[model samples]
Target: MSPSAIPPDDILLQVTPALPLPEVWDAIVRPEQLTRWLAPRVRLELREGGPFELFWDPEDPSQNSTQGCTLLRFRDQDEIAFTWKGPPAFDALMNRGTRLTEVQIRVAPCPEGIDVTLEH
Candidate 1:
């Protein structure tokens, strides 16, 4: 299904972080911040069409990672879009790179602080 066709509540995550928009963007793009919240090993190129790989297993990258996937969109302090696949446990479906899903993250200013919306 297309992105627009997906329902707002389906696999959608929203959070109002205390940090500013820039800091929230850092949590989405920075290596150190990524490791703290996301996978242990991450390789993000920070540009459209660049790599946005995340390795859940520290020793073996191929075992569970978004290997060979690329960023669909990248905007500083605004948004990021990247292709993603499941972990090793779902090898049958996840290994099919062409059938992978897209993960999008949008960071915007809000009344309290920064509002981050993630859709997958």
Candidate 2:
């Protein structure tokens, strides 16, 4: 099916980390930080429409270990949105093929620290 014809089904994630916005933004964009916390390996280009890929199992060295994704939007220390094409299991759960899904992350200052909201 064409991308435009795919129905939308998004997953949202939210968290309030006891850290500043800049730190949170760095953790999201920096490859080193992402490898430490999010994925086994991550490659990101800090620009709109840039190519991005995430390796969940770097040791596997196979297509199944990688997630072919992309960066769609970026706002310094505020928000970043990306396209996530995870494993086939995820696509099966979403009832779609290999169509990319949107994952948007927004950061805002809160009384405690920074509020990070991730919507996919």
Candidate 3:
């Protein structure tokens, strides 16, 4: 099945990280590998509807973590999308609010290495 459609947003970033497409894909899918670069604490289940939690604070789980979000789309080696919650500082405004944002990461092989497009 095709990956879920990510609604258009003004926030967009495109980068060509110096890593092979497969490696880049692994970096996003493998929590163990992602912890080395992405976030200090990573808990991600790489399947459609799987849970994903990324903690930035090593000292506190409730401080800066995406605690109860789940994957909306999971296309192996191609793309992924998950619900997103803001940090604790925005707890009252964003986290406690009715709607939650979504983050999508798309990857492809490129001359430089892996071409990445992240939409939030």
Candidate 4:
């Protein structure tokens, strides 16, 4: 589907990882490691209706975080979904604070590889 076709309520980002489900999930979900690749610092409670925040700088520590976040769904190393309600950054300039409401991530284990789908 095209970017325009995705509802304003949902956005999807998919990635294929060469590692096992647990390994991939751990690396992606780990706050410290996630900052290195995805953002700067990630703080997640990994629970239903918990707060999930991502900071732009780890060293500064006073930066604004992506707030109003919550884990809506989770299935161990299989699937996860959360609410992403913070202001958008440079990449998502048009969507800033627009309630791109739900971010859904799915982990599919197949014979050849594992498909990681992230929806924001």
Question: What's model 3's lDDT at 72?
Answer: 93
TM-score ranking, high to low: 1, 3, 2, 4
TM-score for each candidate, following the candidate numbering: 0.84, 0.80, 0.82, 0.71
**What lDDT does model 3 reach?**
0.81
**Tens digits of per-residue lDDT for model 4, 1-120:** 566788785657777877888888877567877776877768788889886777765565443556556778877888777766543344364335544457777787876678887766
Candidate with the greatest lDDT versus the true structure: 1
Q: Is candidate 3 or candidate 4 better by lDDT?
A: 3
lDDT of 1: 0.83
lDDT of 1 by residue, 5-78 (tens): 77874577789988877778888999889999999988989888899899888798887888877899988888
Clashing pairs in 4: 11-120, 13-118
RMSD of candidate 1 to true structure, Å: 3.1
TM-score of 1: 0.84
| Candidate no. 4 TM-score | 0.71
Whole-model lDDT per candidate: 0.83, 0.76, 0.81, 0.69
Q: Write down the lDDT that model 4 would get.
A: 0.69
The RMSD (Cα, Å) of candidate 2 is: 5.6
Higher-scoring candidate on TM-score, 1 or 4: 1
Could you give candidate 2's per-residue lDDT for residues 52-107 as a string of tens digits? 77888777634443455778899898888888665655566542565666778889
Question: Where does candidate 4 stray beyond 4 Å?
Answer: 1-10, 58-64, 86-100
Poorest stretch of ten by lDDT in candidate 3: 1-10
